[model samples]
Target: MVIINVLKIVNWFRVTNSADLRKYDFSEELTQMKVMKLLYYVQGLYLKLYDERAFDNDILAWRWGPAIQEVHDKYIGQREIVGEISEQDLADFKEVNSDERLAEIVEAVNEAMGNMSASDLVRKTHEERPWKETEQSDVIADDLIKDFFDKNFKVSRE
Candidate 1:
């Protein structure tokens, strides 16, 4: 079962990025690396929290970190995602955000690591087993992500 829709999640980030810039006063817009890393963390956290895979898409271990090819392809040649969120994009984001659990997972990930730089997220993922063990360009298995998060991830309610 496809628990998470990758495009919807991406739209969520795009929409949220705009809001976050104002809410948090972020100087830089979300880059591709930052979005990918956030997606990876959301997938891992969802797996740990729900004992299920978030999305059906395979996450590849790229030179930077875990990356979804679809995302990379979409944002290729873009330095930072800076644009108006279209009506369709906003609707798609609303669809994703309607799922309370999934929205919470996304919110938690953003709150925890959204402020971190792309390089910081890359370094953090590189230290994790899924990225470290998977060969470059190979898919980082969901089971590996689940296992690693089960052992290493700690939930905080604050």
Candidate 2:
């Protein structure tokens, strides 16, 4: 019989400590964590949206090794899969080709990168959420959030 620890496995985060990722000058550390967390969430959402066992499971530009030799792979390219995200696809998203099955995955990746410069700006400012219940002198935060959403989405049907 196999056993599993549901509590320990839930909401688990895979950590990546690349020195290359840390080199960029940060205005605040928490801001950087926020963007990276969003990226992580988006990737998880992508995997959830796709069926890993179906034939012709195209993973777009997700990267994995040529040999199916590792358990810890990008997964999209491991089983019932083909191709990872390429450099050109990373720089220019117009190259990504998809069908109905991959629709959500592509959309999530786009959302992850969309208005990304703003997130980068947020990172550079180093402003973090206050730990205490304190009022802010700047009353424009509400406006800023609204503007951020509006500028990013092409259509707000909701």
Candidate 3:
């Protein structure tokens, strides 16, 4: 349920940000690959800043990059651009929208990474310590991501 909720929030972002992303050439046709990497960065940065993971799902080192199995399966052949979230769930998870710091992190990642092609995103994730250390299909530990981002980015956990 937590993963579903997080997926909803992330997918909602993909949908809502399509217009603004156009200038960066990351229009509405966001690929599954791009979405997954964006989610991974969001999780990593959120963990770095807040000392907590944004989602409960394990981020696995899939062939391409970090991915959530359930979310991956849901969008295997999806071309809908964005996944749906119930109004009640959206209302209940106000923090996904209202947390100003989290919003900034999400926007920064989306803006920075959104225009990348799927292959480029895959390569970028592969360079990440968590993904590199993990074997294919293995879970990328949240602590690893947190430690890497904290050390490399010097992001204050304020």
Candidate 4:
């Protein structure tokens, strides 16, 4: 089934960039409390996965869904507070943000435009994460995905 096939993918969204994690003015904003709460959730789950050595090597995809998105939803804007795409009309974010999930990223963008303070998993806090950094993966998953198709879904070929 697709569930088993999908399980072969190790999926998790995290902002491993030092710069990206430091954009938020943690000391300057009180509303940051909400963003911090979300980080605790994302990081707490990540620590569990890291300790167990789980979700390694693409075997198990830690879903890039609502969980980490709670933190990621902070950087997006409705009409773009950054002079770029506005969140109110954002469709896909992956094309704009490198190695970032589109769904959650756009949600954050939308919220930012709405004047709601929130952030995505790739926080602007500047902290060390327990799990492996997503940015360190030199190759883009797209090419790998193309290879996956070329080999007819054989995990051994990967």
lDDT, model 4: 0.27
lDDT of 3 by residue, 1-158 (tens): 13335666565565555544555563556767777888898889888887887777789998889998867787777744544545654553455656666667777777677667768988988888999999999999889999988887754334
List, residue by residue over 1-158, the lDDT tens digit for candidate 4.
Answer: 01111111101112211223357554222122333333333223322322221122221112221122222344433222122333322322232333233224323433332232445342322232222222442322323323333343221211
Clashes of 1: 0
RMSD from true fold, candidate 1: 1.7
lDDT of each: 0.87, 0.28, 0.73, 0.27
Give the per-residue lDDT of model 1 (tens digit) for 98-156.
88888889888988897899999999999999999999999998899999999998987
Rate residue 85 of model 2 by lDDT: 35
All candidates: CA RMSD in angstroms? Answer: 1.7, 16.0, 3.8, 15.8
Q: If scored against the real structure, what TM-score would every candidate get?
A: 0.92, 0.23, 0.78, 0.20
Better model by TM-score: candidate 2 vs candidate 3: 3
Please report the candidate that would top TM-score against the real structure: 1
Residue 145 C-alpha lDDT in model 1: 96
List the candidate 1 regions with Cα displacement exceeding 4 Å.
Answer: 156-158
**Pairs clashing within candidate 3:** none
Q: Rank the candidates by TM-score, best first.
A: 1, 3, 2, 4
Query: How would the candidate models be sorted by lDDT, starting from the highest?
Result: 1, 3, 2, 4
Query: For model 2, which pairs clash?
Result: 27-126, 28-126, 61-84, 61-85, 62-84, 62-85
TM-score of 1: 0.92
